[model samples]
Target: MQDGSDWYGAATATFGDRVAGAREALGMTQPELAERLGVRIKTVRGWENDTAEPRANKLQMLSGILGVSLTWLLNGEGDGLDQPAGEAGARLPEIRTLLSELRDIRADVDNAAERLARMENRLIEALTEGRVE
Candidate 1:
């Protein structure tokens, strides 16, 4: 935001440029994104040109839908937003280990849910057949 550029304007330009770059990298056209966002092609072009700003909800949706990070859009920092360093390196092996554990826990929860559903069906069948004992 230095060099006499308006801070807000600079921010908008950064966001818009990154948005367009990310979209192009993903091989999406303005019309394609407009369809995904339920916006007009003009609206998408306005965002790319910094002519207009998106609402807060749209911004969040854009981040998710574009597969980038809000921080990357606003500040142009990190590895293309939502991708911080040390996420997959030995420097943060503990964090990676913890992430693996979390995934395992999630899998366990899914397995438990499936087992519970099967158990419920068995219980219902037993009750319907008067085999409660």
Candidate 2:
């Protein structure tokens, strides 16, 4: 049987920092997550502060609710908060190509955001008094 300390270790090792980080990453507060899990806010706080450990069933529920793999939630491997080890014999060219494409898309999105920001600023200035130079 898994002891409380074991559960605590797994939660800390997998989550690092604190369970709050994982909860926050999923855009949930203690009350919000507690509602989702049908638990009390204090239970969530205990998990975050390491004041108590979750049972196995709760851990599994948390893994699913938090949108992380069970293995990752337990072991902190395979796309956990940290990056996993590279697959063996993976070609560097493929990674480079994907990275280049991602960068190009990011640049396009950034340009669009900048243009939107400028337009919004101009609109605000026009409403306030004069055109934004």
Error of 2 at 1 (Å): 30
C-alpha TM-scores of all predictions: 0.50, 0.46
**Highest lDDT against the true fold, candidate:** 1
Alpha-carbon RMSD, each predicted model:
15.5, 12.7
Error of 1 at 27 (Å): 0.3
Q: Model 1 — TM-score against the truth?
A: 0.50
Which runs of model 2 end up more than 4 angstroms from their true locations?
1-18, 82-133
Worst 10-residue lDDT window for candidate 2 reads 1-10
Off by over 4 Å in 1: 1-13, 79-133
- State how far residue 44 of model 1 sits from its true place (Å): 0.7
Give Cα distance to truth, residue 122, candidate 2, Å: 64
lDDT of 1 at 112: 78
Error of 1 at 124 (Å): 71
Residue-pair clashes, model 2: 0
- Number of clashing residue pairs, candidate 1: 0
Residue 36, candidate 2: Cα error in Å is: 0.7
Clash count of each predicted structure: 0, 0
Error of 2 at 50 (Å): 1.2
